[model samples]
Target: MKTYLPQIERRILVRPNQTFGILNYDMDNAYPQRMLELVAQSPTAKDCWNKRAKFIAGNGFEEQTLGKQVINSKGLTMAKLLKAIATDKALFSGFGIHVNYNANFKISSVNYVKFEDIRMGDTDSPETAGKFALYSDWGRKTWKNIMRNKITFLDSYNPDEQIIKEQVITAGGWKNYKGQLYYFNPEVDDYPLIEADSVWEDFETEAGIKIFNNREVTTGFLPSTMLFMQSRREEADNSTDIGSGINTPSQLEKDLGTFQGAKSAQKIIVIEYEDESAKPEFQPYAIQNNDKLFESTERSVEARIIKGFSVPKELINAEKASGLSNGSEKKEAIREFNDNTSPDRMELAEVLEELFSHYCSNINPTNNWKIIPVPANVADDVIGVKAGAAINQLLQSSVPTESKIATLMYAYGFKQAEAEAMCTP
Candidate 1:
C-alpha cells in the first residue's frame, strides 16, 4: 500500500559558493528573502516581528552629533539608521552598515544595507574571510543573468587602526578602494537563524488552516457526496464499444462543477434515467463534525508562534486587555517586553558608540550613548494626579517604607533596584 503525507518546506540551508566567492545564505542563497516572504503571509507572525522591531528601536539615541545631524550625504540620521537596523535585526538576527572613507583615510559616511542584499565571502574559515559581497537580486529569478555592475565587494569591518591604515595606504586612493562593512551577527561563524525560527512551521500551518476554513465556507459546507449512475443507452450512430470506457464527460459531471461554490449554494441537483432499474445512488461520505475542526490546532499554532517570539499575548492582541480587572496588563506587558529586549538595545548602542569614537570626530563619546527604553505608557489611576505627583504624595504619606517601595514597583513601572533606592529611609 502507498501512503501519503503533507510535505513541509524549510528555507535555511547554508552553503558556500566557490564561483561567487561568497557563502550562500541557504541552498538558493536567499534565506533572508524567503523568510521575508514567509512572514508577510502570516498576520500574527508579522505583528510579532513589528513589535519586536519597535521595542528594539524604542526612542532615538540619547546623545546627538555635535555639528552634523545627518551621518551621510544621503541624509541618513542616527534615528533612521537605528530604526532600519533594528528592523533588520528583529527579522534576520543580523544587519549590515556600509562604511565609506575619504581620500585622506578618514571615515566619511555610513549607510544602512539591507540584510537580504549581503552575503559572506567564502573562505577556508569564517574567521579568515575578509570580504563581503552585496547584490540585490540574490534570490530573484533574474539572479543568473544579474548585471556585473550591480554587484559590489566590500572589506569586512576592522577596527584595528594599523590594519585600516595599511590597507588605505596600499590602495592609494579611496576611489579604487573597497569600502568597509560592519556586519552584526548574534552567532559567530554560522548564519544566524530568524527570531522565531523554531515556530516557522507553525506559520505555514496557521495559514493553511485559515485557507481551508475559507474554502469550506465558500462552498457552504457542502457534504462530500458521490453519485453512482448506470450506463445510459446511446443511439445507433453514437453507439461505441462498452469495454472501451473512454466516454466523454456526462451532463451530470458538467452540472456538478457548476454546483461546487458559493454562487451555486442552495441549488438543487437533478438526475434523470431512461431505464427504471438504472436509478442512480447518491452516497454521502462520513460527515465529519467539522464545526470545531482545526480550531484547537489554530490556537495552539498561534500560541507557539507568539511564545517563540517571547512576546506576551496581551501586547499582541489589545482585545485580550479588556478582560484584565486592574487595567495594568498592557502596562506590565510593555515593561516586561522592554526588559526582555534591553540587551539587544544595549548591544546596538554600544557598537554605534564604539564606531563613532574610533573613526568619527563629530560624535561625542564622553556624553554617553543610550537607546531609550520603550515607555510603559500607563496612566495614573487617580484622574487629577499626574505621574510624579502620585509618587510625591505617597512619599509624604504615613505609609511604611516597604509599602511605598511595593507601590512604586507595582503601581508605577519601576525596577526593584530603582524603587528600593527611591523609597530608602
Candidate 2:
C-alpha cells in the first residue's frame, strides 16, 4: 500500500532551462504568476498590496516636468511609469523597464514591462550576460512549445554610447532593433522574493477559508451522510423475477441527487426492501461547529497578511478605529508608514534619476529628482482641538508660561521641545 504524509511542497526552486537558455524563476518558472493569482484570490492580501504600492509611489515625482513628459508613443508619462514600477516592486520586489533607442543612439522612450514576463538568461553572471528572455506566458511552460517567435531575447540596458551605437549598426538601424530591458532588483537575490512572500501560505489559507464558508452557505450547512440500501428482487411484467438486487447504484444515485442541495432540504426519502431486517440505513457524519469553523484563523491570517505588507491596519481600513482621536491615530499611522518606507521611495528615485540622467536628454538631470511624499492632512491632527479658537484664547488670556506651554504641547500639536523653546524667556 502507498502511504501519504501530509505536508506542503516548497514553491521556490531555481533551476536552469537549457532548452530555453534561461533560468527558471522557481521550480515551475512561474513564481510571480502564482503570487499574482494568490493575491487576486485573497481580499486581504490584495488590499494590503495596493496600500503598499500607493505608499511607495506617493503623490508623484517632485519635478512637474517628469509627470508631463511622455515617455512612449502611447502617451504614457513618467508618473505612470513610476506608479507601474512601484506596483511591481510592491508585489515582486523587482521591476523591468524597456528602453528604446533612437536612430541617433539616444534613448527615445521607456516603458514598464511586466516582471512575470521576464526571465534571466542562463549565465554565471546575469549583470554581464547582457541577455534576458521575455515572453507573455511563462506559466504555460512556453519553453517546451517550440514556438521560436514567442520568446524575444532583449539586450540588457547599457548606457555606454559606443555600445548602443554598435548595437544600432549591427541591427542595420534602430527600427529593426529590439529594445533593451533595465531589470532593477532592489534586493540582492537571484530572483527577489515577493514583499509578502512570508505570508503567501496564509493568503492561500485565507482563500481556502473563504471558499469553505461559501460552500457551507451554499449547502445550507448540511451534514454529509451515507445511505445504505439493501438489495431486493422485483418481479417483471412477464412474471419473470430478477435475482435479489436493488436498482443499479448509478440509478439510485440519480434519484438521490434530486433531493440534494439547499432547495431540496427537509425533503423525505423512501426506500423499499424485501425483509424488515434488511432495511436501508442512513448514517449522518458528525455535525460541524459553525460557530468557530475558522473565525480565529481568519482573523490571524488577515493580521499576518497586513503585517507582511508592513501597512498599518488603520490605514487599510479607515473605520477600524472609531473615536474622537481616530483621525489623529490614522494621521500618525500614515506618517509612520511613510517614514518607514522612505528608503524604498529613495531607491526608486535613485533608479529613475540614474536612468533619466544617463539616457534621456530632454530632462535636466541636475534638478532635484525625487518622489514627492503623500501629503498628510494637518487638520487630521487637530481632530478635537479647536486650534484657531484655542490659540486666540491663549493669546488673549493671561495664562502662566508653564500652563501655556503645556497647552501648546497637548492641544496645538506642538512638540515638547518646540513648546519649551517658545516658552523660554
Most TM-score-accurate candidate:
2
Task: Estimate TM-scores for all models.
Answer: 0.73, 0.75
C-alpha lDDT of residue 261 in model 2: 65
Model 2 lDDT per residue over 318-377, tens place: 554433355787888889888977887998998887787755576754467788777778
Q: Taking the tens digit of each residue's C-alpha lDDT, what string does model 1 give over 61-166?
A: 6665532357888798777889999999888878999887765555778889999898888776553277788998988756566565677878888766677777
Off by over 4 Å in 1: 1-14, 63-68, 125-128, 141-150, 159-162, 165-172, 230-255, 263-282, 321-326, 358-368, 378-425
Collision pairs in model 1? none
Model 2 spans with C-alpha error above 4 angstroms = 1-11, 124-128, 141-146, 232-281, 287-293, 358-366, 378-425
| Number of clashes recorded per candidate | 0, 0
Q: Over all chains combined, what TM-score does candidate 2 have?
A: 0.75
Query: Poorest 10 consecutive residues of model 1 by lDDT?
Result: 318-327
Kindly provide the TM-score of model 1 when superposed on the true structure, using C-alpha atoms: 0.73
